[model samples]
Target: MPEKTIAEFSVKYVQVMDEKGIADAKLMPRLSDKQIIEMYRLMVLAKAFDDKALKLQRQGKIGTYASHRGQEACQIGGVYALGKNDWLFPAFRENAAFIALGFPMHLLYAYWGGDERGAKIPKEFNALPTSIPVGTQLLHAVGTAWAMKLKKKKSATIVFFGDGATSEGDFHEAMNFAGVFKTPTVFLCQNNQYAISVPRSQQTAAETIAQKAIAYGFEGIQVDGNDVFSVYRAASEALKKASMGNGPTLIECFTYRLSDHTTADDAKRYRTEKEVLEWKKKDPIERLRKHLEGKKIWSSRKEKELIDWANEKVEKAVKEFEAMPAPVPDDMFQYLFAAMPRRLREQRDYLEKYVNELRREKNG
Candidate 1:
């Protein structure tokens, strides 16, 4: 037989609004004015949270923290598109997702401060506490999605991870499983260009992360992660498809990280300032502000009011978080199981006695 190609595939790139605030009307999502502003507010709130968290880390009030600075559009836009019942599985650095899902900012602050109780998600919210290890949450999301499918539920499961995670074994396993099983899951990858010091170029040789989905028998689409409209539209569509039992989709949000990888790492060591400056020109919030300005619904006064409101809310949450009592070392032993094991009990008692002895010595 003559050589022939059986199949061909190409990834779709979505960008409803360009960095210059020019929007393609035909491609714009059918979002109302209220919904658009709500998306904008959520992004602003995420920025407020990121700013305060970074400052807290610098002042020694919080442990090492990740800043989702320039990727607010990706996080907030994708998360805001989720239905109330859709479960959200987030990797660490999904502050905006948590905020959009109505996770209390005070509890978020507490979590970053190293208190485990902060991550104890409320019963009403279907979000899982963000995992710190790369790519692991994808499996968990797939499992929940499979369960939903098994139960004939009408909700999808969405999982968020970074670009670096796509290279992990778990990413492939989850994608393959979800694809074979046709699970109602959405994989949201925030391609912020770098994973810590490693750039995206080093993470994978593939042209786009979304294309990886093709290998798993699913659809994958890339979107301008900095453009809120594109992110929201893609996520909304993917989630709807998942809930409707159409199987999985991968959304690779092409965004940039304006801040360092975390409070502890300096991005300037690896990437160029000029490169970052260029991405800053594509600032998501500013682009949205310009679009709103064109619509005559936003002005400097409104911007100021919004900023003031966001800052006030963040400050209030910070105060509430600080006012909460500190977590005891015994807290770890308290929550593990319904009944504490004898071995763990012995360890907890030993720790208590050692701590008390140290306290006495310091006092004396």
Candidate 2:
């Protein structure tokens, strides 16, 4: 009888799925048919929300918004790997990730529409409020993981940040602390190749962002960011390790941002149309759709049905967001502190009086 040798090589970064729709049998995640279908549906819903948000921003319904257009697989795949008890600390561009984790679409839209209430996640969910300052949330995630370790909890923490954030001091500090303390955390960096107009080459000189984990004494792996299977497997493995007290793992999902950094920026000024066109060929949804087709489960009819359902859901959310009453000016002051400072209270009172006086004059 032949001795079963333990596999010594690293997992290949999955790219195209075989024509049979099975992940390379040796490198695949053990995903169920129901899970695959759910992943695909979530991806479609995310893309729809992104499109609608962009449209709303253009029409001035929302403030400047970021589109996670081509990076759905990376975001969804990474977040879906976590257990319900695990926590998520996200950067600004992870709309799909939050949505996949049960965040209401209307809350997300409301956040972009400039309502602070949008940042509030339900107590039942372990997601943190979205962090806008780049790289700052990494520290918070590390702290949470550290606390969990001290409390002897079984959960892990996942922090999502962009490649550009890797250059920040907070990123370094978080990694260093997680490594030194052996905290249960996974640092998921979505290296989408650009930070606003700045390309990855300009962001760092390292061969790969994941490789940076070596400096912190942890394992790191780079996976195809556009391949949901690869992203999920990598993240899941890292998360499993973290949950078992193996410390942190850095997983870099190599992907690209196919749209402008945000609605406020003009990507055309820095990137060529040809480059965007080229990346479009690597569309995450198309890869999954092709794989599903190969399995004979995905058809044009099914695709249309799913898309229509997603569109209707998005439209309904939009209506709900729009129907909410206009926010009061005083509402902004309410959350700034546990109790308003005297100066702010004076300003609030003065503004209220001024508005009332103006209304009276107009009525007269």
Candidate 3:
């Protein structure tokens, strides 16, 4: 038999803006000056929310929370590309994504505070509650996309996960199904370089995470996750292709997690300060700020106004979250079923009575 060449593949890496904040004008996405400013504002809000969440966690105001300190551009940029009717299936650590998609800040605050009510998304938005189990939401996203395809809808679905998720069997299966079915879905993997303490080098052997999509018969693109414009352009293009009935696109966002994995995690144990400092030079918010300044669209006064506005919004959300009524002792059993199961009802009633007794004793 004669040797023959089967196929050759290539992956594209996108970067509209460099670390020095200079952008390739021809590669810039079509966005108004106002919209670009809004992107910066949203990134600021994400950082503000993250800072507050960490403080709240330290003070025992909220439970152990995941912080998206450095990944704001990856989250917000991709999410901002979605249409109103598009759906989002997110893994945890996506606070900025939710905010960019117009989710209420107070609700996100409540969720981090361990309140189940916060997961109940408003009817107008098409987003699922946060999935804590790694790589599991891919199935849900695929199913939603299949449904959209069956119904012949123009909307697409985006699923967000981390580098670690790409190693899961569920991720591979989801990709296969998405390819075979030709579903309108976008797989957005935020490769933040670290899956908790494990580094990206330890996650997989593949040269680039984006190449994983080729096995499933789809195109994958790697973008500068720290550059908001690059991430936004990749996501926007993928979404448009999907809406036009194209199959899935896997976007590998090459970024870093600036903070510890979560409140319970101490990244210093595994990584060095020098490494963190190196990544800090590519900080997304600062890069965008620099870009805006070069265009003369941003000034010291505008910076102050932006920070103050973000602070005000965060403060209002915190107050609302704190002022909300406490969950009833039996509230845990209420959300799962329209009518409680018999055995669950008995347990709930017992807890309710016990809580009442405790209240009565306190009153006396």
Candidate 4:
């Protein structure tokens, strides 16, 4: 037999709305004007939440916090596509997604304020608490999907992680398991150009992160992360396909992290102002606003009203967060185990004595 060429692969890139808010009629998803406006509102609210969180951190109201500034569409669109029954596992920095999923903003603030109780997820949302450890949540998502498959449920699991996580071994392991078992999983990678200080180009040699899915025997897609319509369309199709038992799909949302990696790290040290400026032009919230404006459904008055409403909501949440009782010192160690270990017991006893001594000295 002649040496024949092996199979070839090509990644599909989708963009329904341009930076100028000009939308392609054919590529646009089946969303009503009301739905579009709602999406815009959610995105704006998320941005407002993020801006406030940053200020709070600077004022010592919160601990180290991650910013979701430029990736509003990627976060909101992905979460909006999910059904109420579906499960979602999110890595850290999913503030916008959590907002879209009806997560309590005050609880989110508490979580950032270093209260573990804030992570006690509510029963209403079928979602996991934010996973801080890099790509580990991918495994949790896959496991949930596998369980759902065995139970023969018509629901899929979606996991959100950043580009840096793709480099973790857990990502590939999750991909392999999902591919081989045909689990109902959707892998959403927000390729936000850089992973902390490391650029995506320097992380992997592959042309695109979506292509990695091809190697695992599944389809992969790339989308304009700033375009709400495109991200929602891709996510909706993938989730439905998973529910229908079509296995897994990887969606690479090409977005940018306009803010610093976290409150502790400055983005300016690694990236240039010019690059940030260019990405600002593609701001997800701005683009979505422009789309509504082009449709004559949005006006400056509406924008002002929305802004006032969002700020008021955010301020209320901030007040609630501030009014929250201080975390118990025992909460730091006791919650980790059912029965406190000997070492922990000793540590607790010492802390108690030390606190008592301080109280006595203050009284004296």
Candidate 5:
């Protein structure tokens, strides 16, 4: 037989807004004015959380923290598109997503302060605690989606991970299973350009992360991650498709990491200042603010009010987190199982006695 091409594919790129704040009216999604304002506010609130966390980490009030500085649009826009019944499976650094999903900011603060209770998601919210391992939650999200499908539920599942995770075997396994099972899931890859000093270029030779979905028998789309409208539209469409039994979709959010990887690392050691400066111009909040300004709904006064409101809210959350009672170290042993194992129980008893003896000695 003659050599022939059996199939061909092209990835779609969605960008409803430009860096200068000009939006393509024809491509704009059907979002209400209030929704637009809420989107901007959520992004601002996420930024406030990131800034506060970084400061707290510096002051030793919190452990190492990751800041979602330049990727607010990608996080907030994707998460805001989710319905109440949908479930969110997030990797670490999804502060904007959590805020948009209505996760209490104080609990989030407490989580970073090394208290696992902060991650104890409420029953009403269908969100899992942030997964610290790279790409592992992809499998978890796929499993959840498979369960939803088996139950004939109308809900969908969205999972978020960084660009570097694409190289992990778990990502491929999850994608393969999700495709084969026809699970209602959306794979959201926030291509923030770098994954802990490893640039996206080094992570994969593929031109775009969205294209990876083609091999898994699903549609994939890339969007301007810094453009809130674009990310929202793409995510909304993908989620709707999934819920309607169209199977999974991969949304590659082409964004940037504006801050260092975390409190323990310095970005200055690897990337250049010029590159960082360029991405800063594509600030998601500023772009949305510009669009609001063009619509005559935003002004300097509104900007001040929003900033003041965000600051006040963040301060209140900080106070609540700090004022919470200290956690009992023994409590960790109680939550692991319904009935503690003999070995673990013995270890717990030893720790309790040691702690008590130290306390008594200090008192003496």
Candidate 6:
């Protein structure tokens, strides 16, 4: 056999299992058996919800949906690493992360189904509303962390974004401010190789996005985003460091986007089936499953149990979302301001009257 070789520049912060079902006993993060089982179940549920949402969009039951198929591990691992008090500022694509953080599945589906109530997360949860504008949430995370510092609170904020978002001005401004202020924040970028149709190479010329943090006066690390163990360990350490007032850290999770950008996108127009098939070889869930099986902690019976439970839960959420009463047209205008303006009220009344007149004419 040939001698084993290691790369000179390799700096893996933490990785418990390799893609080939190999385990690193020394580096694996300590997780109880119950915690491991829960993580596995959550990932399965996330994927099931993603699939059901796509079907709902196709059936006209929901508005455009973003699928989190291959990105389950990244979301679960990162969110699981947070303390109960830590705040989560998420981009629109983080359905799985929100669910992992205890956001109700019914509310999440309702939000995508065009209901404003879906945006109202319980204030006690510390999760912000899903931000549709790509990189804007980064700023919110930085601001929240800054506030915590001012209030002398011991909490850090984790903001999730895609590779394409790093090009946005808000991404840079947020990082710069966080570094300068030494705010307790973690900039977790899921570099899934493509930002919509744009490839990673076109997104930036930087060899590694994590290295950008070094320029901003903080530590930066890259990890296998698909490896749950890697993401959990890195995020846990980063959060701990921030809580200790050591300042912010940037973590680049190298993963892949296995599905179309959203229901509104056709990835085939820009990518190939062959590329997606190749990525399946690195499936995070499968890799972890194999490792668990090796430890005799996973079996066919457990797999079936989790799948059945997830499917039933998702089915129930769908029924609830569908049963919701249609939103009144006036609801759109009502939430825009605390008190409706006179002119706006007049416009709303006029529109309501016109709609009622049309309805009467049709009925007659």
Candidate number with greatest TM-score: 5
Q: Write the per-residue lDDT of candidate 5 for residues 1-364, one digit (tens) a residue.
A: 9999999999999889987665577889999989999999999989988999999998999998989999999999899899888999999999889999888999999989988777788888889888888999999999999999989998899999999999999999999998998999999999999989999989999999999999999998999999988888998998998888889999999999999999999999999999999999998988899889989998899899999999999999999999989988786676557889999999999999999999999999
Give one digit per residue, the lDDT tens place, for model 6 in 225-283: 88988899999999989978889999999889898999999999999899999888888
Candidate 3's TM-score: 0.96
Comparing 2 and 4 by lDDT, which wins? Answer: 4
Please give the lDDT score at residue 114 for candidate 4. Answer: 91
> Higher-TM-score candidate among 1 and 5?
5
lDDT of 2 at 297: 81
lDDT by residue (1-364, candidate 3, tens digit) is: 9999998999999999988875677889999999999999999999999999999898888898999989999999999899888999999999999999878998998998889888788998899989999999999999899999999999899999999999899999999999999999999999999898888999999999999999999999999999999999999999889988988999999999999999999999999999999999999999999999999999999999999999999999999999999976666787768878999999988998999999999999
RMSD of each: 1.8, 5.4, 1.6, 1.9, 1.5, 5.5
Prediction-by-prediction clash tally:
0, 0, 0, 0, 0, 0
lDDT order, best first, reads: 4, 1, 3, 5, 2, 6
- Pairs with backbone N, CA or C atoms under 3 Å apart (clashes), candidate 1: none
Question: In candidate 2, how many Å is residue 332 off?
Answer: 2.7
Shift of residue 192 alpha carbon in model 1, Å: 0.5
lDDT of 1 at 182: 96
Q: Mark the regions of model 3 whose C-alpha exceeds 4 Å error after superposition.
A: 337-350, 360-364
Query: What TM-score does candidate 2 get on C-alpha atoms?
Result: 0.91
Better of 3 and 4 by lDDT: 4
Q: Higher-lDDT candidate among 4 and 6?
A: 4
Instruction: Please write out the lDDT profile of model 1 over residues 227-265, one tens digit for every residue.
Output: 999998999999999999999999999999999998889
**TM-score of each candidate structure, all chains considered together:** 0.95, 0.91, 0.96, 0.95, 0.96, 0.91
What TM-score number comes out for model 6? 0.91
- Each model's lDDT: 0.93, 0.89, 0.92, 0.93, 0.92, 0.88
